[model samples]
Target: MWNGDGTVEVYGFRVFYSEVDCVRRIFEKYPETATNIRPKNQMVKNAYMNNLLDLIDIICLAPQELTEEELRNAESQLLELVEVGFKLDWLKNKLEELCVKKKKMEARGARMRELDGLIMEQRRVLWELETELKNEENEAVSDSARLGFEDVV
Candidate 1:
C-alpha cells in the first residue's frame, strides 16, 4: 500500500530481485534515487533495472541540460510503467501474433491479384477467338455468292 502523500521515497511499482539490488545500490549512492522511487526494469521486471540505471547514470554524468531533461523523463516513465503494471510477456506475444496475421493477409491479397490478372488474359483471348470466327464466316458467305453468280452467267 502506498501512502497517498507524495514523498515518492518507496515505489509502489513491483520489481524483481535483481532490480531491488541495483536500486538498493543506486539509492545508497544517490540521494535523489533514495527519495524518488521509479522502478526501472532492464529485461524482465527485476533483471533489467541495472541497465536502465546505467543509462541514467551515463546521461546524468554527461554535461548537457537536455540530458538532465531526458533523465527526468526516463525516471517518470519508469514510474508510469510500474503504475500501469501490464505484463511485458503478454504484450510481446500479442505483438508477435499480430505480425504473423498481417503477413498472411498480405500474401493472400497478392495471390488473389495474380489470379485476377490471369482471368483477364483468358477473357481477352476468348474475345479475340470469337472475332476471328466471325471474320471467317463472312469470307465463306462471299465466296459462295460469287460461285452462284458465276453459275448463273
Candidate 2:
C-alpha cells in the first residue's frame, strides 16, 4: 500500500519500492507471508495470520532502523533478522536523541526571544535618552542666546 508520500508498505514492511514491477516481483516471489496473507483471520489461517500480525506489531513497536554510523555494527543483526528482525533498540535510541534535540532547540528559541525583548527595551531607553539630550541642548542654546551671547557668534 502506498503511504501517500511515495513510500510503500509491503507485507507490513516499509519498503522504498518506487517501481510497480519490483514490488510485484518481491510479492510474487515471497508468497508465504509476503503475499496472499491477510492480517485478519482467514479461517484456520487465523493462526498464521495471528502470528504475522504479532510480528508486524513487533516491527512497528521496534526501534528505528540503524543509522549510517551504526549500520556496520548492525549488519549482522539485520542479516539475522531479515525474515524476523525488528530494530527496536535503534528506533528507541533515535527517538530519545530526537527528544533531546527538540528540547535544546526549544530552549534556544526561548533564549532568542528573551534577547529580543531585552534589545527592544534597550532601544526604548536609548530613544528616551536621545530625546532628553536633544531637549537639554536646545534649552542651553536658547538660554545662551537670551543672555546677550548672540554677538558671541
Candidate 3:
C-alpha cells in the first residue's frame, strides 16, 4: 500500500497514477490509525457524494461558462446519481433546467458563428470595392496626364 504498486479501483473522481503515487507517499509518511472508521465501501460512497455535490455547485454557479461537452457530462453524472437512489426533486428540476440551458447555449453559439461568417464576408467585399475604386482613380489620373501631354505636343 505504501509503494502504490497495485492497481487502485478509484471510486469517486478520475485520478492519474502520479496522483495515486503522491497519495501513497503521503500515507507512508503520516500514518494515522483512526479508531472506529467507516467501512471502505461506505467511505468511497461518501467521497463520491461529496465530489458530485461539489460538481453540481460549480455547474450551478457558472452554467454559461461550461462548454456543451462539459454540460453533457454533468447531465450524465446527474442521471447516474438518480440511478443510485439519489432521487431528489431538486435534482430532477436542475436536470431539466440544464437541458434547456444547453439547448439555448447551442442555439446562441450557432447564431454567433453565423454572424461572424457574415461579418467576415462583408469585410472581404468592402476590401475588394476599395481596391477597385483606388485602381479606377489611378487610371483616370494617368489618362488625364496623357491627354494633357498630347495637347501640349
Candidate 4:
C-alpha cells in the first residue's frame, strides 16, 4: 500500500524510493486506483523478484556497514532467500575463501603432529642415554670393589 509519502509497504517490508524505483513505477501507472491494491501488490512482488540480487548486495556487501549481529541476521536472510531460489553471483568468491582457510588449518594441524612426533623421539633417545650412563657407573663400581677385595686377600 502506498503511504502517500514516497514509500510502499510490500509483504510487511517497506520499500523506499532510495532502495528501488520499480515499485514507484507501479504507483505512476495506477495513481488513482490505490483502492485496487492487488495490482500494486503483484507489481511489488515483481519488483522484488527482479531486484533480488540488489537486496542481497545491501544485506551482504554494504560497505563499512552492519554489525556482527546484523551480519548474522543477513546470513540468515541470505540462506532463507537462497532456499527460495535466490541466486548470488559472489558466492563463488566466498567458497574460494573458505577452501583456502581450510587448507591453511590442515597445514597447521600437520605441522603440530610432526612437532609432537619429534618431541617424543627426542625424549626416548634421552632416556636411553641416561640408562646407558647408569650401567657404566655400576660397572666401574663393581670393578673397583673386586680390586679392593683382591688387595685385601
Candidate 5:
C-alpha cells in the first residue's frame, strides 16, 4: 500500500528504513531493503492500484476459474514486480502491439490460404485446357491426312 500522492506509507512491508539490523550471526527473515534501492531521502512508491486494476484483478481472480489440472499445467511465475508505472505502461503497450501483430498475421495467413485454393483451381483449369488443345490438334492432323492435299493461299 502507498500513501496518497504516491508516497511510501513509512510503515509497511515496503518501508525505506527499519530499526532492525542485526549482526550477520543471526538469521533475518525479511532483510531490510537495500540502500541502493533509493536515495537516502527519496521514498519508493508503488503504482496507483486503481490505475493497475486490470492486471491486478487478473492476478487476484484467475485462480478461481482454473481447475486443479489447469493450475498445475499453467505456466510458471509469469507475475512480476512492477518497479515503476512507466514499465507497467510499456508492458501494457507492448501487449497491445502484440495483439495487433497477431491479428495482422492471422489476416495474412487467411489471405494466403485463399490464394492457394485459387491457384489450385486455376492449375486444374489450365491442365484441362491443354488436354483439349492437344485433342483438337490431333483431329486437324487426321483430317489433313484424309484430304491428302495442301491448300495454297
Candidate 6:
C-alpha cells in the first residue's frame, strides 16, 4: 500500500520471483490492477474504478489532488458548464437571425418610402395634365360658340 508521503509498504511477507513475474504479466495485460494489494481479477476491476475516480479528482483539482466526493461534484459542475455553453450558442444564433431580419425590414421600409414619393410625383403630373385638358376643351367650346356652330354641342 502507498502511504500519503509517496512510499510503499508491504506487510510481513517475502516477495517471490515467480510471483513477481506473474504480477508483472497481470499488470502488463491489465494495468489498472497494478495498484491492488493482491493482483486478482476482482482487485483489478476495483483498481480500474479507483483509477477512474483518481482521474476525475485530477480534473477537478486542476493542479492538485481531490477526494472522491469532490470528483463527483466536479462531474456535475462540468455538466453545468456544458449546458451553459450550449445555451450561449443558441442565444448567439437567435441574435444573428434577428439582426438579419431587422436589416431586411429596414431595407423594405426604405423601398416603400421611395415608391410613395414616386407615386406622389406621378399624381401631381397627372393633375396638371388634366387641368390643361379642361382649359383646352373650354376654349374650343367658346370658339365654336362665337363661330355660331349650332351642331357643336
Number of the predicted model whose lDDT against the real structure is largest: 3
For candidate 4, write residues 21-53 as lDDT tens digits: 654553455343133223345555545444444
lDDT of 2 by residue, 1-153 (tens): 776766565555544455445545534654543333333433333343334333333334323343433433344433333334322344344445544555566689799999999999999999999999999999998887754567666
Stretches of candidate 4 above 4 Å error? 1-91, 144-146, 149-152
Expressed as tens digits, the lDDT of each residue in 55-149 for candidate 5 is 43333433334444433222121123243311343334444444455556668879999999999999999999999999999999887774424
How many backbone collisions does model 1 have? Answer: 3
Q: Candidate 2: global Cα-lDDT?
A: 0.50
- Worst 10-residue lDDT window for candidate 4 reads 30-39
Candidate 6 per-residue lDDT over residues 6-59, each given as its tens digit: 423322112333334433443465453323333335444334333433433344
Candidate 3: residue 2 lDDT (0-100): 26
- Each prediction's TM-score against the native? 0.40, 0.44, 0.49, 0.39, 0.42, 0.39
Off by over 4 Å in 2: 1-16, 19-85, 146-153
The positional error of residue 86 in candidate 6, measured at the CA in angstroms, is 4.7
Ranking 1 against 3 by TM-score, winner: 3
Q: How far is candidate 1 from the true structure (C-alpha RMSD, Å)?
A: 15.0
Question: Which residue pairs show collisions in model 1?
Answer: 42-48, 42-49, 43-48
Candidate 2 lDDT at 14 equals 46
Question: What tens digits encode model 3's per-residue C-alpha lDDT throughout 1-153?
Answer: 222543343333233454555434423543331122233465465454554555556567555777777766777777665555554445557667876887887899899999999999999999999999999999998887745666888
Q: What's the TM for model 4?
A: 0.39
What is each predicted model's overall lDDT from 0 to 1?
0.50, 0.50, 0.59, 0.55, 0.42, 0.47
